[model samples]
Target chain A: MTGALAAAAGGGCHIFSGCGFPAPGLQDFIWTPFFTIGQFQFTKPMLLAILSALVVIGFFWAAFRKPKLIPGRTQSLGEMAILAVRDQILRPSLGRKGDSYLPFLVSLFFFIYIMNVMELIPVFQFPVTSRIGFVWPMVFTVYFLYLYLGFMHQGAWGYLRNMIPAGVPWPIYIILVPVELLRFFIFQPFTLGVRLFGNMFAGHLLLTIFTLATWYLLSLSVGLLYAVGSFALAIFVFVLETLVTLLQAFIFTTLTATYIASSVEPAH
Target chain B: MSVRDRSGRDTSVEAESRALGLNIGWTVFSYLLSGMAAYGLIGWLIGRAVRVEILFPVGMLVGLAISLGFVIWRFGKRGITREETSR
Candidate 1:
C-alpha cells in the first residue's frame, strides 16, 4: 500500500505502464528498524507504543494534577474515562469491591485503545498491538495477576480445586477436569492476546488492500469508477476499523476483569 | 423480575449477569477447544502406538462430545436452578 501510494504520488505508475498491482501482505508489517543497540532494535511500532503510553500518562496527570471541588473540563474528561472503564468493564465483573483495581483497568483500556487507534492515524498507520510480541507481555501480566489473585484469595489447593466447575458428576470428572484446567491455564490467555492481534492485523491488511487497489485502479478512463469503488470500500473499512479499535480494547479489558473476578471468587 | 438491592436498584444483578454472560461465552469456546485438543492428542498417540491411523479423528470426536455434554450439563443445571429460585 505504502509503495503504491508513494508511486502514485510520484506520478510513476498507471495501468498502461506495465506495472503490476502491488498486493499488500505480511511484508507491510515487517518494518526496517530505525536504530539498533547490540541485539536490541527499535522500530516505528515501538515508538508508537511508547508515545501511546506517554499520551495516556500525560493526559491523566495534566487532567487531575489539581484538586477540585467540582471538576473542570480536563478533570471531567479524565473522570469520564475512569468511570467508563469502571462502570462498563470493572463493575460488570468485580462489582463495587473492585474499585481498588480501577486505576489498573483504566490505564490498560486507554493504553490498548490508543495503540489500536494508531493504525487509523496518518503517519503512524500501524497498530502497535498487531505485533504479537507486543501483545504477549500484556497477556502474561493479566494471566499472572489472575493466578496471583486466585492463589492469594483461595490458596494454592483451593485455587486448583476451583478450576473444577460445581455440581458435575463424579465419573464425568475424569474427562472434564483436564479440559477445565487446560482451558483456564492455556486457552484463555492464548485467545486474549491472539484475539487483539488478529483483529488489528486483519483490519490493517483490509485497509491496505483497498487503499492499494484505489491507487492501482486510478486512471483517466474506465478504471476511475473502479478506483472510486475501492476508495469507498476503504472509507467503509476505516470506519469499521475505528469501531473495532475501541471494541478490541474493551473486550480485552473486560475479559481481564472477568478472569480476575473468577479467580477471586470461583468458577460458576 | 429483576432482583433489587437494599436501595431498590437492580443494576447489581444486571451487571453480575452481564459478567457471567461474557464469562460463559468464552468458557463455552474454551471447553470445546480444550476437549478436542486434549482427547485428540491422546487418541493420536494411542493410535500411533497401536498403528491405528483412525484414532486421531476419533479422539477429536470423543473430545468434542464430552465437551458438549459438559456444557449442556453445566448450563442446563444453571437454567433449572434459576427457574427453581424464581418460582
Candidate 2:
C-alpha cells in the first residue's frame, strides 16, 4: 500500500503525465545517514531518539533538582507525570512491591512518548518509534531485564519449571516445552518491539496519505472538492494519530510493567 | 492502584481491568502464533526430507493445541485466583 501510494504521489508532480499518485512508501522510510563513522551510520531517527532521551533526562532533572516542598509549575507538571505513571500504569500491574522499578518505567514511558510526539511537531514530522532500528534495542533491554529478574528471583531451574507449570503427562511435555519456550523467548520481545513500531508506522503512513492526497488533488475544477474532502480527512487523521501515539506509549509501558511483575513473581 | 481520569470525573479501575484482559488476549494470540510457526517450520523440514506433505499441517495443529493448553494454564479464570482478580 505504501509503495503504491508513493508511486501515485510521484505522478502528482507530472500532472500532464497522467501518472500515478506519489505517496509515501518503504523508500521514504529509508533515510540517508547524516554521517557515518566506520560501520555506524547516524540517521535522522537516531538523532530523534537521542534527543528524546535527553529531553526526558533534562525534564526530570529540572523537575526534581530543587527538591521543594511546594513545587513550581515545571516541578508540579513533572510530579503529576510521575505520579500518574506510578498510580495508573505501574501500580496496577506491579503494586507497591515493584516501586523500585518506577524510575525505569517513568523513563521508558516518557522517552517513547516524546519520540512518538515528534510526529506532530512541525520540524520533526517523522516518529522515531516508527523506525524498527530505534525500537529493537529498547525492547531488547527490557527483555534482558525481565530475564535477569526471572533468573534471580526464581533460581535457574525454578524459572524453567515455573514457566512450564506442572502435572502434565510426560508424553505431552515435548510439545508444551517448545511452545512455552518460544512464546517467552521470542514472541514476547518481538511483539513488544513490533507493537510500538507498527502503531507509529501505520499512523504516520495514514497522515502522509491524507496530506499528500489533499495536495495532489488540488486542481481548479472538481479536484478542489476532492481536495477539500482530503484536507478534512487529513486533519481528522492527524488528530486521531495524536491519541494513537499517546495510547501506544501507555500500552507499551503498561505491558513492560506486566512483564516485570510476572518475571518477579513467576508463580503468580 | 486506582487512577482517576484527567477530568477527575471517574476512577478507571474498570477500564484498567479491561485493558489488562485485552493485554492477556494479545499475549495468548502471540503464543499461538509463535508456537505454530516454530513447530510448523520444524515439521515442514522433516516432511520435505521424508517426502511427506501432511506433517506440516499436522505440526501446525499440534503447535496450536499445545499453545492453547499453555494459554489456558496461564490465563484461565482459575489461574488468576481471588487475590489477583480483586486487584
Candidate 3:
C-alpha cells in the first residue's frame, strides 16, 4: 500500500503536487523494519516468512495430533494434503522410493503455498518468497541436502563421473567442464531461487498497479468507466495470481524432488 | 498409479512426473546465461590483453554451445518414461 503508485495517488488528483502515473520499483518493495537490535533489523517480510512456516507446522501438528485409524474429518484432510503432495510431487520424480522424504516434501509444498498465498491475503498482502533472503534458505537447503545425498550415494569419484556426462570426449572437457560446473554450482540454485522470487515479485507489483489504478481512477463522472475497467483488471489479476501462487509452489517442490532424485542416482 | 493434476483428471504418475521434470527448462536457460556471462567476461579480458575484440563474442558463443551440449547430454538423452520403467 506504500507503493509509489499509492503515494502518487494519495488523497485525490493533485495539480501542484505533480500527479501522474508512478511506476512501481524496488522502492515499493522495501519495508522499514519494525524494530532493530544491534546490527540486526526485523522486517515485515521476514515476519511473514516465519509466520508462513509456523502456520504450516501448526496446521500439520493440529491435524495429525490425534491420529485415527478410521480417520476423523481433520485426520482425513491432513491425510489428503499429504497424499496429494506425495502423488503429484514426490512420486513423479522420486517414485515409490521417495516415500521416506514425504514429511519434508509436504512441509515444503505447504510452506511455499502459504507464503505465496499471503500476497492475496488481506492485511498481509505480500509474498515473502519474493525476497531472496526467504527463497535462498530453501534453495541452499535443497542444494546442500542434494549435494550430501549425491556424494553419499555415489561416492566422490562416482558422483563426479556421473555429473560430467560420458562420451563427450577429452578434447571437449575444456569447454564442458566449466559449463557443467557453473550449471551445477551456480545456476542450479540461482535459477531455483530467482524463478520463485521473480514470479512473486512481478505478481505483487502488477496487482499493486491494477489495484492502485482502480482507486486512483475512481470518480463520479467520466472517470467512473475507467475505474470500473481497472477494477475488472484487478479482479482478473487476482484470479491469475491464484494460479501462479499454486503453480510456483508446485514447481519449486517438484524441482526439489527432481534434484534429490538426480543426486541419489545416476542422472541420465 | 494415476495422479490428478489441478484439473482433477486422472493422469499416469510416470508420464506426469516426466512431463513435470521438463519444467527444469529454466535451469538449462540459467546455466546458459551464467555460462555466457562468466566465460564471456573472461574471454573479453583475454581479448583486451591480446588486442582482439572479437574473442568476447566468440567466447560467449562457445559457452552457449557448451551449455547447450550439457543440456542435451543431461536432460535430452533420457527421462523417466512409462514404457521404459515398465521394463
Candidate with the greatest lDDT versus the true structure: 1
**Residue lDDT tens for model 2, A125-215:** 8899998988998899999998999899888888887775556677777767777788789887889899899999999888888887777
Candidate 2 structure lDDT: 0.79
TM-score of chain B of each: 0.76, 0.70, 0.65
- TM-score (all chains, Cα) for each model: 0.91, 0.87, 0.87
Q: Best-fitting candidate, measured by DockQ?
A: 1
Stretches > 4 Å off in candidate 2: A1-19, A166-171, B1-12, B15-19, B69-87
Residue pairs whose backbone atoms clash in candidate 1: none
**Candidates' chain A TM-scores:** 0.95, 0.91, 0.93
**Which candidate tops TM-score?**
1
- Candidate lDDT scores, in order, read 0.82, 0.79, 0.78
Q: Indicate whether candidate 1 or candidate 3 has the larger DockQ.
A: 1
Looking only at chain B, model 1 earns a TM-score of: 0.76
RMSD of each: 3.5, 4.4, 4.3
Worst 10 residues of 1 chain B by lDDT: B78-87
Better of 1 and 2 by DockQ: 1
Q: Which ten residues in a row have the lowest lDDT in candidate 3 chain A?
A: A9-18
Candidate 3: tens digits of C-alpha lDDT, residues A63-103: 89988789888789899999889878777667677788889
Q: Tell me the chain A TM-score of model 3.
A: 0.93
